[model samples]
Each structure stands twice: as structure tokens, then as C-alpha cells.
Target: MAMAIRYERPYSHSAHWARRLAWVGLVVFLAAALSHRFGPLTTPHFLVLAGSGAALSALAVVLSGIGFIRLWRVGARGGRAAFVALLLAALPLGVAGYAAYAYFTRPMIYDVTTDPFASPPWLKVPVAHQDFLARPPVTLQDREIQATAYPELTGRRYEGALDRVLEGVRKVADEQGIVFTGEAGLENVISDLEDLAVKPDGDTGGESAITVVPVPSARPLEEGFLPRIGGPSDVLLQGEWRSLVFGFRFDVSIRLREEEETALVDMRVASRYGPHDLGLGAAFAERYLKALDAQLLGIAGN
Candidate 1:
């Protein structure tokens, strides 16, 4: 007798929910991107939404993968739809993955400072971040990074009076929309280094105010003054970056020393945060210095 084979009908599946979930992921990702790119969505809000959307899309991809496998193994209906679901789900998942990687791997610094060791210390306030209390004043890594990245930002000597230099510094800062919070007069501007040093926490004896002081140089300038005094101005800058109203506070010190026929101007800008500044600090310094040049040279507006 010949053996007979029986053919069974394949299991039917519309896979409607799986396909819809994939489209939902894509839609959510696009919404998040649009909100972040041009939005009422704040940075924090966008971050939360983007992160959540990515995770949901990843889940959808997994589900779609399972659906695809089922359709293939049992010869079920909607195989094409299952494959489409998988492809669509992947788009958001990949974007979210990249973003997470960048956030964690990239440096934690967004602010920059020029003279970290000599920059004014922040007061013991709730708004102060961890950067204000950095140990060793300036870190070796920060020095190396700045030296390599911005070698041209060193202090320069200009011929002018101390008062003029101070005024120029203020004017340039104002033009750049940087707000000064505190002012140290000429006397305090040339104070001793030890007195102006940022002390350890809980000292309570040190002045909380930002001080202007002379950059202590080993060799005295015979043609000019021994040490040039710099006025320290605490500035808070507010701007928008990536759907967020970003604010960063730093110090700009303008040093002026009088000579027979000229004065030297040394300007330095340093921020409390480090590792990276997104070039904001460097750009600010460059712009202010250029404007000060125009002002000191009396060529501004001409």
C-alpha cells in the first residue's frame, strides 16, 4: 500500500497590532525630534521624551522581530507587514542609542575659564555647582586641554591707564550681553596673591566677593610696572542652546599696568565648569578682546 500525505492549511494572522505599533514608534520619534528642533519643549522635557520614545521603539522592534519569525515559520499571513514593522521600529531605536552614547561619553563640561587657579571663587550659595569647589583650583587636565586648544588666548600688554582698561572691560562685556554681578575697586584689584587665594570650604574667613588682583610675576617689568593689576568682574551670560535657556556664570579679569608711555592689558576668562566648554568661553574671550582693541584704539564705530 502507498503512504498518503495530508496538507494542512496555514495559521492566519492579520498582524494588525504589530504593524500599528511600529508606525506608532516612528511617529513618536518624529514628534520628539520636531519638538526638540523647534519647540516650546524645554531641554529637560525634550530629553525625557526622546529617551522614552527610543526605549519604546526598541521594544517595538523586538516585538516585530518575533512576529516576523512567527509568520515565516508557520507560513502565516502578513509576512510583508511583519517585516515592515521591524524596519520602521529600528529608526527611532538607533537614534536614541546614539544620543545616549554621546551624553555619557562626552565630557561633563560646558563652561570654560582662562585662569582657573586665579579665577574668583563662587559664594556658598545653593545655585553653585560642583565646579566652583574644584580641588587644586585648576586641574592639570584642564590646563593641558586649554593650552592645546586655545594657545592664542594668553594675556596681552596694552598701553593705557588702569581706569580706562576697567571701563573698556565693562563696555565690552555689556556689548556681549554679559551681566556683571560684583565689582572690586582698584585698591583691591592689586591685592596680594595669598590674600586673594580661594581657600578650602568652611574657612568662612575669606571674602565671598569676587576680587580683582594683579597677576603675580617673578620678574618685574622695568619698562613697565612690576605686576599688572586685573579687575575681576563676575558675569552671568544667558542664551538659548538646543531648546534650552542656558545660563553660565564666569569671571573676566582685565589687568592694566602703567608705564611711561603705555599700559599693558591682560584679560582672562574662566568658567566654573570644565573638561569641555563647547567653545563658548573661547569665543566670548576672543570677541571681547577684539572689541576692547577697537575701543582702546579709538577705532570703534569708525
Candidate 2:
């Protein structure tokens, strides 16, 4: 007897999403081409560009998964060739096509880190599904410190990005401190940390007060498809943010820009949602602030 091959069809939901992602991904590819054909995506809006592309890639992934399930269930008798092509090329094509645009367009051009800094690869898998495996990081009082401007990132444009956010956080902490502990600022900082960690993307997780956007906010000169069509997973990162309320754990991503260089400072203590963690997101942030301050001290050597 010939070895039997299994034929499986995709579930309804999976097939639906897969079809949707394929269409969306194709549109993104075309927009990228048009952008390159005309003028590349410009500054003050690069983050939005990048965030959109990243999100589209994610949607493509969702679609591909759906299609694969369909193929597995239905068998390749009807669409085997198309299924195989998409399954193999889905992510690679997305990565290669978009990466090429990113290299040339560089929409995330924040002018922060000229020198290379370390960053792990992409989440590599679903953040929600992955096990924390450890406790989250936290910080204590008297540890928080301020960050300095990078030498390469000049001009007021970059600084303007964080000014409002920094001021709002600082002011709330100060006000809360007068009535609570003189350490109100620390509490406020922790509260903000909580917001970042817990809130999910608007579509799936529901919208919160916080959302990420480009620096030096501006309305583009003309309309474009990719920018016009926003999708889920626009959120680059988030945390549990319990440090502000119940004193849970958290972490934050710090971007540095001075002159023309942009650098990222990601401070973590323990692990978030991990079994062993002390759940101290604020405390870790406090520690990061201190470490940043120390780095500044060494660089300025004062």
C-alpha cells in the first residue's frame, strides 16, 4: 500500500484572517514601492512609518497562520501550490521587502544612537504566550536620576519629543508627594510605568491613555495609503505597571538623541509576570534612572 498522505482543511476563522492578511500585505508592498518611487518617508514621521510597516508584517503573519491551518485541514489538492508558496514566503518576503525599504527609507530616524547599542532580536514569538520564567524588576527611592543629551543629537526638535511626557510625569509626582510622601515623584514615576506595561493595543487590548507616536508631531504634506490605514499592534511595547499601585514589577524603553545620534536605554530589574519576581517595576525604573545618572556623571566627569 502507498504511504497515505493526510489532507486537512482550514477552520473558517483561520481561513478568513489569512485571506485578510494577504490582501493587506500586498497593499503595504505597493505603498512602499510608491513611496520609493516618489520621495522616501521623511523625518518627524519616521516612527509612524516604521510602526505601520511592523504592524502590517504582523497582520501578514496572522493571515499566513490562518491560511496554513486551512491548507493543513483541506489538503493541498486544490491550492497546494499557492499554499506552499505563501507558507514558505510569507514572513521572509515580508521581512526582506520591508527591511529593504527600512534600510533606504529609515523612517525611524530619531538621531539618537550613532554608535551601536545592544538589542535582542524581535520578540521572536508572542509576548503574551512566552513564559516570563522569572520575576519582574523594580527600583527603590533615592535611586532615580536624570538623563543627559547625547553629543551627536543636536537641535531642539529631538528634545521636544520627551519634554511634555517628562514634565507631565514629574509634575504629577511632585503634586502627589506634597500630600503623601515627599517621595511622591517616585510614586508618580511608578504609576506611569504601570500604564506602559498593562495597556494593550487599541483593537485587541482596548485603548488606554497612552499611545506611541512620532516625535515633533506633524501632518504630512500629502496623504498615503499605509499611513491612512492603521492596524492593530501599533504598540511597540507595554508593561504590567503595578509598581505605581500595588507595587508590582515593570520596565521601560528610553530613547536618547543628541546631535544626530539616537540610543536606546532599556532598564529591567527582575522579570514581569514571572513567578519569582518581586513585582517591582518602579524600583527597577528608579535603579535605571540612577544608572543613567551615573553614566552621565562619568561622561561629564563632574
Index of the highest-lDDT prediction: 1
Per-residue error (Å), model 1, residue 81: 17
Query: Over the stretch 153-242, how does candidate 1's per-residue lDDT look in tens digits?
Result: 554444434454556666776777665554334552322234333456677775564333323222222454332223343222222122
* Cα distance off (Å), candidate 1, residue 200: 56
Which window of 10 residues has the lowest lDDT sum in candidate 2? 178-187
Query: Which stretches in model 1 have alpha-carbon errors above 4 Å?
Result: 1-137, 187-245, 248-262, 267-275, 299-302
lDDT of 1 at 72: 71
Q: lDDT of all the models against the reference?
A: 0.52, 0.33
RMSD of each: 14.4, 22.8
In model 1, where is the ten-residue run with the lowest total lDDT? 235-244
TM-score of each: 0.44, 0.24
